[model samples]
Target: MKRRGPFANRRLARFCHEEAGSILVLWIASLVAILGMTALVFDIGRVQIAHGDLQRFADDVALAAAAELDGRSDSITRATNAASKLISNPQAYGGDGTLSGATDYTLTFLDGLPAADTTDPSGYTTTDPIDATLVQVVTTPVTLDPMFLRATRTLAGVTGPAQATVFAESIAGFSMEACDITPLMFCKPTGWSATQASSIGDGILLRSGGQGAAWGPGDFGFLDVSSSAIGSSCFGLNGAKLIGCLIGAEDNVTGCYAQRGVTIEPGQKVGLENAVFNTRFDQFRGVMSQFKSNANYTVAPNIISGLVPQGNACGWNNVSASTNSIGLPHDNCFATGGCTRFGTGSWDYANYVDSNYGNRNGILEAGEDSHLVSHIPAAFAGTRYGVYLAEIAYAQTAGLPSGAILSDRDETGIAQCSSNVSTNPARRVVIAAAIDCTKHPINGAATNVPVDEFVELFMTEPVGTGVGSPPSFDLWVEVIGSAGVAGLGAAGTGGVFRDVIQLYR
Candidate 1:
């Protein structure tokens, strides 16, 4: 070194020594900082993983709670137990990593829905929605602290704490339909004895004030008569007086017929009035007297098809009035209408059979249609149009074990009522639900009562008696979610829900 001033040399020496020690101190400080930052990252990542696990556990607990609810009892306790088994820390407190001042979780019940009365006016009932019956179990929310950084106030600004919470919800009940049976079985055709034929009306007498023609025993013949187009004309009948005759071979004159025979329409219920037909005009005079009969008769025509009968006293030749009895057991036929006395062709006879009788009611009269077992009576009448069944017994079995009473309107605009079917697999009450309110009906296999249990229950009970009456129904449990039993598709999905529940008694 060259000769230098004392102040300059001393300053240079101090700079070298002091600055060298300062660099080592800085390096050591930076290493410590790096280690602390690395430790913080580890703690944060571990806590994040734990939080995710707890969240999944909460979800599992919710599903468990719903399943327990399906048992039909003890819902809240079951939910709590299920939650404890799922979450890691059963008693984990909610808050900023502190047990104090935390929001406690709890399991609770949801109230059920009200019942419904669908009887009397109509024959169906319904249940409430599923969302209204849902219950829930929730866990207490808590705040967790970061392990490394939280220990020091200086690192507080680096990371923040987070809160965790979990929640779960579930649903659970059966559905039912029934009918009513009552008095008045019309003409017991199926059960009647052969000797019962004597019970038909005696000598036919036209009840006064009634329209149409009536006939008593008489004989007459026609020949060489004056033909009239629209009015009665004179004709030689047994060489005596003649009236209302048309002599033309092919002429069809209204109120004037002395030519040939008439052809009755097919599928028509006809009434005979001591009258016979001649196929040819040449035979008209020779067989005129053969058209007569010895018995006095009052004939009435009724149309029976399917399960209904259509007729009015106005169309019958000798009906005193449009009587309601014709639609009842004695007057109506089950398979066909009326008797074919003089001629025999393609005749479809009436066949009346039910679980009650198991056979035909009798031969259907020409003026009558469909003669099945007379579960209803002719003299029977009701204030309203409906079917009523009473005094039915209920059993626990799946099969419908009872019958109901019914009252229905007749063609004469009267209410005809009837009842009395046995209780067994053979003769159970045919409880039916009408799709439309206006028309009386029963459940059909396709568009109506498709379910076996539903049909059995309905047939066992009375579906309110009367033409337009509905049955009584009770709506009980409505299930939802994976745990619920009332929905159509697989449970657990979001769409799983019970839209309707119907019960019958």
Candidate 2:
């Protein structure tokens, strides 16, 4: 309005010059807001990442425990140790906080579980196919303490120092069953036909054994029997009483004579000297009794080791002897010629028996003509008569252990025959095996690398009668990855990956 000159203009401009555009205050305020937001995001993200990591680690530990529930002696201990080792340093897996609180987890067989039973008149309803109990695998709660987030003292009053709990659970079926022993190969000295016998005695001789009865024939130091014979004989004496019989003329010695099958007097022990005792019986009545017993027999590719050496020995060589063997044969009717078949190819082999050691031989030869056929097949059965052995091998590439545990909580060393079932026909023996993901590598890689690691094995008994008959059994095996857990769970944390396997022999 005054229309001043250049000097006037300069004075006015200076006076009008305001600090509005300096923006120092606005910039500082903006910086404070942005920094605060960033800090919130960083701390929250850190806590979240830690929680996620803890969960993942917990899962892995649980899975390890679950895998150990196969009813092994130290399986639970091993799995617990493995779980702790897996997360010993959770930070490696991106966990920002340390888990504190309870240590030690457990893998155990569940008790009082309802037996798998079904009542469908249709006779086609699927019963609880699983014969054993459920295995419960529990993982201890993993607790994590906040580290990065704790700095916000304000949160101490709000939510308090962040704490988290992680858990995992899994179920496993009965890993083991009672020991059952069935004859893989058997022959009454009279049960064998000339065609079934070679110069090597009766082939019907089979073998079996367990914890207390580890004695085998070859191991028989004083007996000096064959190992193969002891292998089978080990099964016979395992739980039975051992009393040596005097080898005198049948009728010549009555007082010192060993009654046919009387219970032995306590504290009295005897041995048959100068004579090797086989299952053979000379009496026609004895021969008839042996033939009428129900004794199923079959054979596998290899012999399983029991408490005693497979060879025949009774505290003789190695402590125990095998009752079944190709060398030392058990015969009820050994005539001058050899094993005599009842009818042409009428001899049959089965695992179930109706009598104990005393009377088992009575029907050994007359199985076809006696009550052996009337005996109903038991619901549970196994390949071997009284004992069942299942061996699982993990290649060095698989991450799993090379050994497996039997149902009886036995670690069954890396060798074969570590797992055993009863030969009784009333029981069944089933084997399910998988290669360790850590030990058995796929694609020839040095390590199996993580995938759906799994392997399925099939066990079967041949369909034929008599010990000398060729074994004609079939088994199927499947190998897969994560799918293996279908029988088990594979949650990667609480999941148990078990390959479902069935045994019907």
Candidate 3:
């Protein structure tokens, strides 16, 4: 209560008026603000990254589910399982526990899936699962912490609970238009069970040295010839009564691209030796190989060695005079069924034609056409044709040594994973547009029909036995693409609009 000293008063004044510490105070305040902002940014970045992961999860689930829309009976169950698996599965990066399940998603079956051209992802109408061509999946909101943001806000003492939630969505589907399509067609019989399509999709239905006519999907290799052959007459008689009939045929089925308006004519024999096959096999080395379509809509060359070499050698030996009639016969072997039948022949003999050397199921040659006989005389032609046909049949029955199988399966080094067979695993797969052998054509519709399905095949062997046989292929197949109940119409923009797996929206 007494009078204060002058020193104390001066000290108080100095403390109050001093500017020396003010700069430090300002700096600390500024640093706090900057740190808060920086933390906010880091938290926002974390949220964004988590959102991206959620989005990818959506996309992956969509694709996994959509692939099940191939007109199979178990489409819904399969698709649901696919989505659940993706959602409940661990994270791709962190291996974290799953955040969602099938119940957390909204799946829609699309009759016509929205293409990339559709600006809105909602362009499609939901269809029944049985008829769905596409599947869509959306996930529930997934919560993630605003880690740095909350921490900074807490340090600033200015925020309530601060966390973020995110969601992601996607659409997926497949397209099957003539664009970028291999020129082949198969019949999807009018009355087929849903199981039939699944059977083909199941993989590796047919294989060389595995089974005969009783083996897998279609017993004989009766693929429809392309209606658009280079030459007018049946050059190699791929569609002839002798060869095609021997392989097998459907009443209303013609192997042509129906979408292009090219129909197969009745009994219109077309050769398999066209520029397309040659360019694809010989030039591109794609026999029993996989090829992706280029911008030109043509298949690119094979990356690995393929069966084209063996096929070329087989064809060459058939045409060479020095090889005599030991190779493929030009037209006569197909004209009259008298070639080396296995039962009647020995290791070596001229046996094609009326079972002179052996007895076997031979397609009676329908008389040599002048234009068709240009490749070689009867003996050479017969041997070539005979060897080819025999090899084809044998392939379906007894899958030959397999180089066509990818190295992943070790070719024939080990047993594979298929329900049908126990030996020689499969590595690569092929998707071909062909008719279903189990299906017959609509009566009185058209002479030669178009392809109604996309068949999935696993290559078994390069079509040959040992070193002497020709390059041939055997497959295990299942139907993938479907024309629905209405039959073949349009699937998508020549596969461009479709992705085996895609991210939409």
Candidate 4:
């Protein structure tokens, strides 16, 4: 309708339809898409990281709980309390920032084999709180917001809740097997059980340079279990015989007690000195602490809480150095302590300690603490003290048995040095691991060798050649876990071997 130049009009049309601006629009769209993907990734990745953290937390709680499952009375309660404390206390791990608070964590005790777990070869069960061998730990579901995802709504104009629920879980348990152990067992006459009285076990005391405190042939307490590699009997009491032969009687070195009437003749098995407590092997290490020292000639107070140790040699006025028959068995069954009942002893040392016997002959004499140890354990890593079970034996069983049915049965392999490798469930060896290298020990349930409890003991000194003076052990022990047997036979002589603590999930 108007007179206009065609070229000019064409130019204007081209400008309006220019493709340069198309690139800008395309870039904007691309940026929106890229932002959406990044935001989604942030949420997914954040949740995944949180999930991993939860898994580790679960494992920690389970292990803590399992350590307290010692297979004795109040075991469940102790385990529960231990696990709950580890979870709830922020000081235990990190805090809610790194790990979920203990309140957000939960643990469950399981007995018997679980349907989901198929890890163990023997498949030990964790059936009851009282006898738990396994524990399950779970974290409360954690909620997280996808910060990048939510932020993208302002730019990309796309949105959702951008939140996630994450959680993790794990299962763990405790068991024991024989590892490096000393051949010597301070013979515990009592088994581990609250109700087990006569068979509960007693803590044995060995005196250096005493009339009857050394190892000898025919003396059955000498064990060969302290070598780098164990040659102890795997099948029976042959180990004990071998050990007794290794450290045979060298001109009456003195290793028999008058109480047991241990008259070690030319070629007869010898017996151990004596147990201070009648049957219960209660706090022997603690009592023996008076005999442990690092200084070459230093002394420690041999403290026996209930009894006053008398020393005629040191001039404390208990009388002559004669064997006290107050608590020991007088029956001449097998020889020295040959009792009609195995693991059952009639300990009368209390009468002497109580001043009933004028002289404390058989019982330990108090003088300067003559501990022969070079290194004082529990000076660091107080959890390293321990002792060897001179003997161990067990009868076969099917399911995880409850309580110590046969506490102290007739276990062989006493004084068998090479055969002193622990193999008997009946012969329980309390093993320990050093938490640190040095720390003075304090007495408590945590350190005591309670019945049915799995303990870790550290061997401070390696075994000296059995050729010289019989090798002795300096150990630190702490109860770290408990156990339930699966394939173990009826205990024979004290059975000891490699045990393990493991996780199923």
Candidate 5:
């Protein structure tokens, strides 16, 4: 090399001192940090989206399963099928895509849940299908291969698990609201279940208690149709308004009642016309005479009460002792006054058949429908309600002859008061809330009294004047079954149950 010049030495020294490219080195290092931050945000967003998808799936499955919990024997089976087979949804972002089969989620049936939503779900679960009312669903955990996080980790020369797992859970329950039900509630007998198999077809004698008297088992009272549960139409209802609600043709005029509880109408409400109850049997008398023509108060298609009209007037005199009169008799225990509110299902079936159809063997001479006969037990011929249905079928097949006249009465199943006859056989059946009187003491004007269950009662006879010195308003009915039971064949007939499903979490 030649001897270094002064200019070259100065240029070299100036070049070493200059800071021109220093910023470029810092910028390259900052790029790595910026990229890592962007990756973190993107991965977090994907995980959040996946969590949202899982939550939705869990909610839908819970609702579907809860809808099928109707307190039936097959409730859990139906709920499981509804949950696994009825719903299919797609999950995007980080899930396994489609959620279809049982493997995609887990189900837990619960009988009770803590009132609060924040409570954990481990303790309140149930295995019994009939008692299960709430349902819980949890999505299967899904492993996610994070798009940005994995690349960020690789670039950093980091090894180990880089995937994320996501899942969600939800709870739901089923409830019912009875609509268009009769404004009536009876004291539930000791140890009565909603679906009491033995109690079906048993005669129940419902008597209205004295004003201000504490109601006990077998006593019944009117419901406050004016309650908010019944809506505004029946609000502020008084004496005449109460009668109108009782006689209204539209079922919803009385409004909807919750299964939880009901408000008791304040008074004993004495002197309600017998005609009001008789209208269901097509016997319109007193105040009910004018409503016969109106379709709303249409009489039942079969109105075969044992009592003959008194001299063509629309009134029934005492025909209970008459041999020719053949109405469905009260239980043998009732005539003797040996039983309490409930009567042994043993009524004189042979006498009923002989007095009405001239058949002593309890078999119709004309061809009888086997379906109707199937419901009648061999030991008792038929239950009062079962016989009532069979009589309808009998009248349909064999033209009503003078011999088949009900209880030596000119009145037959055909309505003479009006041509607009009620075709619904369930017209004679009314839904009544059964309450435990001991647990909930009701005198009058009670609020939010808990109901044990709703029951379907077949009117065995029209409301009648009682025989005691003070006299009572007595109604005789046969228990059909608990409302909405599949075995009863009367589910949804009386607008007794309206099911509602909702998510809890």
Candidate 6:
């Protein structure tokens, strides 16, 4: 063993006590903490960026899905398809950078949303597609691997979650507004459902409600088209305004009615304005006699009303008894005055064809008859509306001119009154709001009366005050089906609906 002197022992003690390199030791010790903190900040920022990307994706999906909730039976299916296929966005940063699709998110159709965003959606959501007006979308959770958090935790011997999960959720609502719609509202027939296939082709007798009286099923009233309800376009004479709206011209009433509610016109709206409505049949009468050549008040291309000329205009009394007349007849129950409003979809089809087209057998041999038969099902062949459409088709393809005389009485399917006939056949179809009067009663000038649905009504015949004409306040129309149905010609094309979609959360 070697022995150290006192001087060497003193030098060793001083070196141990020296503090010259103390800062380097301290800095080395803190380097691990500094790196861990940096890693935490970077990982947190990446997670936040991923969350933001997911939120944007959710918002887009919700909007796309909500736009298809049009109160139809396939609303949910349509919405799901729209959401799954319409939107495709890539989530980057902390996520795996995958494109979004049906599998990336889950959708919930809701009839109503809770008052608070934090409320559970299971309680308010619905499986019924027709009733769902809201949609909620939640993205699948994305697992993130932190850049250094896991390694730092392992080195520190800390037991915790190795990976972080992040996701986003959003809610949206859909609403509809009917723009450039006719200013007409009628009580929905009892037990009528817009989605019911059986409701189509039924005849409906819409009668005007007495002034200041509560409206009921089959009763109709004018909508408030005053400047307050619509806009400045309808600021003229009350009669003229009403006639303009009924005419449905481009320069006429300009406004949109929300599906949620509408304002009822005030005062006595006595008649259905037979003169204005008669223009559609090419039979101008009363005040409408002067607009015979006006394009705005054009007549339907096929104006085959069963009336013979009485002078310059056709008279309602000229109609033939039985099925000799080409005009669409009312339901048997309605003709007998037994049914008040809705018809039982039963009519005299054979007699009608026998009288107008020389029997169904002869007409079936005509050109394009096979095509017509295929389009008009046998079940709908008896319907007044179906027959009317068939007549128009026959006139087009069977070499029977639009103006060709149908009966010996000089009743033609052409507009003799107007030179510029309406090219759009829907001129005779009135789009009216159907309201559930029992649910939301209307006394007089009701505000915000909820509408059940919008119905497309085909004018079965012209309104007139003639001896044989229906009461001026009564309107006879055949149900073409509810507007916005899945597949019902132009009415199903969503022309009446102005959809609005918005994000809730």
| Candidate of highest lDDT | 5
Candidate 5 versus the native: TM-score?
A: 0.68
> How far off is residue 444 in model 1, in Å?
25
- Model 3, 185-275: lDDT tens per residue? 3333344322253332222223221112222233223333445332222234443322322221111122334321234322112331112
> Residue 136's C-alpha lDDT in candidate 3?
71
| Model 4 misplacement above 4 A | 1-8, 16-26, 88-102, 112-127, 150-161, 181-339, 343-502
- Relative to the unseen true structure, what is the Cα RMSD of model 5? 6.5
lDDT of 6 by residue, 328-402 (tens): 677889878878798877776655555565543434334423434554546456567666666666566666554
Most accurate candidate by TM-score: 5
Runs of candidate 6 exceeding 4 Å displacement? 1-41, 60-132, 136-167, 176-180, 194-197, 223-243, 246-272, 314-326, 350-380, 396-402, 447-450, 465-472, 485-501
lDDT of each: 0.25, 0.27, 0.39, 0.35, 0.71, 0.70
Instruction: Give lDDT for model 4.
Output: 0.35
Candidate 1 residue runs with Cα over 4 Å from true position? 1-30, 68-74, 81-105, 108-147, 150-357, 361-505
Better of 4 and 6 by lDDT: 6
Pairwise lDDT winner, candidates 4 and 5: 5
For model 4, residues 359-442, the per-residue Cα lDDT tens digits are 434444553112212232333211112111100111122121321112222111121112112222212233211111012121
Candidate 6 at 30: error in angstroms? 15
In angstroms, how far off is 193's CA in candidate 4? 5.7
Error of 4 at 378 (Å): 20
What root-mean-square deviation over C-alphas does model 4 reach? 18.5
TM-score of candidate 2 against the unseen true structure = 0.27
Better of 1 and 2 by lDDT: 2
Residue-level lDDT for 162 in candidate 5: 95
Per-candidate clash tally: 65, 131, 61, 104, 1, 0
